[model samples]
Target: MVNKSRMNRVAAAMAVAALVSVALPGASAQAAATTPRIDLRVLVVDDGGSSVEAITAELRDTGVPYTRVQLGGSGRPVIDAAFLSDVVDGRPRAKYQGVVLPNENPFGEGSAEMAALVAYEAAYGIRQVDAYTWAHPGVGLEYTDSGGYSGQLDGTQAAVTAAGKAGPFGYLGGQVAFEDNSALVPESYGFMGRPRAGYTSYVDAPVGSGRASLVGEYTHDGRSELVVTFGYNQYQQQFRLLARGIVDWLTQGVHLGQSRSWFAVHVDDVFAPDARWNKELDCTPGDYACAGGEGKESTIRMSAADAQYAAQWQQAKDFKLDMLFNGGAGEEWKAENGGTDALTAQLVADRAKYRWLNHTYTHPFLGCIQDTTTVPWTCVKDASGAVTWMSRAEISAQIRDNVNWATSKGISVDRTELVTGEHSGLKTLPQQGQDNPNLAGALADNGVRWVGSDNSREPAQRPVGAAQTVPRHPMNVYYNTGTNAEMADEYNWLYTSRAQGGSGICEDNPATSTCLPAPLDTDTGYLEHIVPAEARTALRHVLANDPRPHYVHQSNLAEDRTLYPVLDRVLDTYRTLYAPNTPIVNQSMKEIGTELGRRAAWDKALAAGRVTAYRIGTAVTVKAPSGVLAPITAPNGTKKQLLLGTADFGTAYAGNRSAWTGPEPLQSSVTLRLPG
Candidate 1:
């Protein structure tokens, strides 16, 4: 939960890779990398660039292991290929495979050495790093654009364009632009900030066969005119587009090395019972088709039986997808009389294609602000009138009951697998600790695995009754916040347009105005459109953050059980790996749910004195003094043999010293026959 902040959303496709052509000014819709191609020796040449610290910091944040070799010596011409090889050989030739030009003239102790290093990049595939340069030649870099513009490596360029006007110079603080259309980020430095000025320039992207993928234009300002774009992870389309473009132009895939991205997709409204409810259809009496209206309703609501399961084998292919997580969906509408049959067949047919997850017994918003069953729920609500959930028993019922039904439906539920009882709300009760456990704990106790209390779905926080609630961040469990609002707000035209108060608040600045920026994020759209697609995209960004990430979709399951062989393999690559791409060998959600139900029943019996427990080595004997007396008791000196894996009956001792042993499967009766 956020406090004192307006709002934000997740990241967008282009935001991930803002790869643009400096020469073309308005090309790439983004926003990457190498490792597996050729194992080339790497060298780190340093120049006195100010952002060196920032660049290093970003690399470390990734937590990916890499070797760094620093070039050090008194001023000398070390920029030649031989210089790089000599240093690499002295250390470990084969070990080195990449280069970091954190600053300019990486090959050198001097400018002459730098020229030699540039040539080496051609021979051995080395990704050179230049934080910023002028978009057009005659600006920050010496790379002459085909546009007939040539400039020095610094921003100070003479007036060769005849405009006699200086180039656009400002802080490249937000995200580097891909083309000239939009910003790489949604902070104040977004399109709302970079207006087209006389000096604003762009370059061509495919810098011919041998040159880099891009060229640039430089301005006269001390700052670099072009902000070179790079990708950390390619969750969205940006990186793939750029990589393909580069590969096509250079005719090389080997140039791209070990870098990779995790892919996944989820179905909520897209291929679930939820979509069936959107429009009324006409059918027979028992048939769901009756009302031929456009909107959904009780009598004529849509059902999951048809959308997710009603399809014939051929139609099922439409629902197939490429993904890292198979986000389980809520399709209760399919459980209806006729719908149930269809959905059951659907699950049986399609279970093989995906992993099954326990989304919820009945996908209810566990912490819904208001009950839609009573009145249409809305985000805005009166404080005192805030909605509460069904009773704990009710919540438990929904979860347990659903798991049983799913299992009965032939879905191989891994009960150890879990999804939030209700995803968007708080996972716990207002009170904390064991006795006052939250939804996650309840799910755990009940054998449901992978509980997410609250997610970054809403991505908000506020002062609630003088309390500040912060979200919990978990990798495979409770993924607190995914993306920020500022990043998400960029797609919406309203956020970019300037108003009377001004829509230009720098995210780097304090959030004093609604227009003020916050941080990198994707949007959640307006309050209206949170269809299942919303959930899928949200999960996509979350998986994108971690390279080769395994997102355990406790919420997903397949329609065909036979396809599980293949699904499991795919899941191994994407799910949590106790060992890489290996099976969990642990309990599934179905087993957990069943065991939990059994335990709950057992506990109830025990509370009624129908059962007990004991250590492995306790002995006792029961004796009756009178036939008509109550529960029998044994003398203090008596001992009883304790059996393992068996229920413990009460010890035959008198008074408070009387003890009990193991458990009761499910009985609420106890006979007491003691001597008075």
Candidate 2:
């Protein structure tokens, strides 16, 4: 009496229902049961090209963890399913959160390696960055020969698309101008092309009668690729300006490390007069090279009016200048001029408006006593043929006296911060190649935690007794120049060829200097040439996440207020390029020193393989050696998980939330929950 046909129909119906459960979105219960673990690391496939190297440099500089696979290296690991991913505790795990390829495909078409990478990316929902690629349909763009352009991109002005402004590159303002460092040399090259289907342009440049993509995202086969057309090196301004966007996009705005534009200016020799540059002699009059110029020496110092202008400038710009004051030199100037020193009085009255640091008492050389009889001075030595160094007591008095002077004037100064006269006492290469033996003790005596060093000389921070050295960059604006003409004259002397009516130092140092075809006219050079060049250099440093303060003499703030032009350019250009979300991080010397120290420790931990971070579903976990702060950048709304509950994570920066963090109390690792 059994209905076999009815039973068969019921079985078929059951099978159909099961298939529908797997096919419909949000109904695949088994597939939704577990989310794959995505390791917070990037995979970089290097073709040994500058484009790949540039992105790798950005990764390294930003402290993002990445594994590099050299295509040409014999020992390089193979790209395969096993290498790219694995099953961990019965759940799928992606080995990398993102991938950076030299181009759309370094591996030939139909190659198994390329297939493996594509499959892995698609399965993990990970993004890829084609660091540099030609415009072609393979990358979702039409060939440049078709309604596009192909050539040098130097001096080209590119704009971010609406998609870019709403996504990873939101930090950047619309325009991105390619660098034209040398008119004779093509600094940048690229192909711009019309986007094909599945392609969305992030950045584009004018081509023909329409705009074509320079950078764009291509989606196909369930994966995305950020395609870049231009060729650039790590040091190029164009690359730097776009580097952040590339990284953010590749990682989908979630990864380790954080970046910020940093800019700080230190005005040295405050309250003191700086020896003027003698254009006629092409040397500073008081300097040893100028033989009979001592009698004709003149000094440039800020008057009360200049001091007032400086305060007003700071207020207008909303930027603080670090004033490295020399009390004894101000007193000497006062005596030389009149009993009433208006500059000192004005600076004291508005002291709270600026940051004050010790620049020694009289700005005397604190290294070995210089034997200035020679053109390039040599260190004075005693009978034993050993260098006769400035004593520790003398160095201590210089530091102590300046701090006391600041205190007496009710000008707040950090006793722990000092910038030695000329960054001396550390080393003066070729003459005093070693630090004065007594300098370290003097720093300790004054409780100095940070002392300034010249970045041009010793760019890396190092220990000095119980303190550390905070290197400061010497700006191109000459310390001896107050007026624009003087600055231009000195710049021309240093940069022009001898045949061009100037010293040929640039020719002698071909590796470091670029000689001008002709001398810059003193009248128009400072405004038209020098300001932009100096501003560009300084902006490069800021974009590179450099926290080192740029140093210029107080003389640059006097007379013409020449420093303002360079500073203005830097500020204005930066504002024009970056959005308000990515403001310049201006920190005190102590704060910068601390940040550098933390980064060093974190980098060491990462290098030692002591740091482990991975994202599982909406949860991120990080473990590092105790006391080492791990830098983490995650999408906004991420929360740090505490023992009992969770707290909002990191401060917002550059469209994401990031911070240098360690684990909470009673925890050995950091855990964060990403927003749904």
For model 2, the local distance difference test gives: 0.88
lDDT of candidate 1 over 1-676, digit per residue (tens):
3321112211221221121122112111110111112221223444444333333332332211233444564664434444543222223111223344543333323234443443343333334444333232222332233322322112111111111111111101111223221234332110101112323322222232422222222222212223332222233322221222221111111111111223232222222322111211311122233345334332222133433532342143322331111122334444445455443454456665554555555555554344333322333335795434444565555567666766665666656544443343353333211111234445544664334333333222222222222222222211111112221233232223344223344322445323323321334432222222233343343322222112322222222111222233333323321112211122232332333333334334433543221111122122212111112122223332333233323432111113322212242222222222
How much lDDT does candidate 1 score? Answer: 0.30
Q: Write one digit per residue (lDDT tens) for candidate 2, span 1-676.
A: 1357446534643443343322322322322466888888999999999999999999998999999999999988988767877768877778899999999778764456776776677667889999999897778998777898999898999999999899778999888889987888878888999999999999998887899999999998678999999999998877888899899898887789888899889999998888999988888888667956878898898999999999999999989999999999999888987688999999999999998889998999999999888868998888999888899999999999999988889989888889998899998788888899999999999899998999999998888988888989888988898899999999999999999878899999999998988888899999999999899999999999888899998999999989999999999999999988999988889888888888888889989999989998788999999899988888999999999999999999988999999999999999999999
Best by TM-score: 2
Query: After best superposition, candidate 2 residue 258: deviation in angstroms?
Result: 0.6
Query: Candidate 2: where is the Cα deviation over 4 Å?
Result: 1-33
TM-score for model 2? 0.94
Against the hidden reference, what TM-scores do the models get?
0.38, 0.94
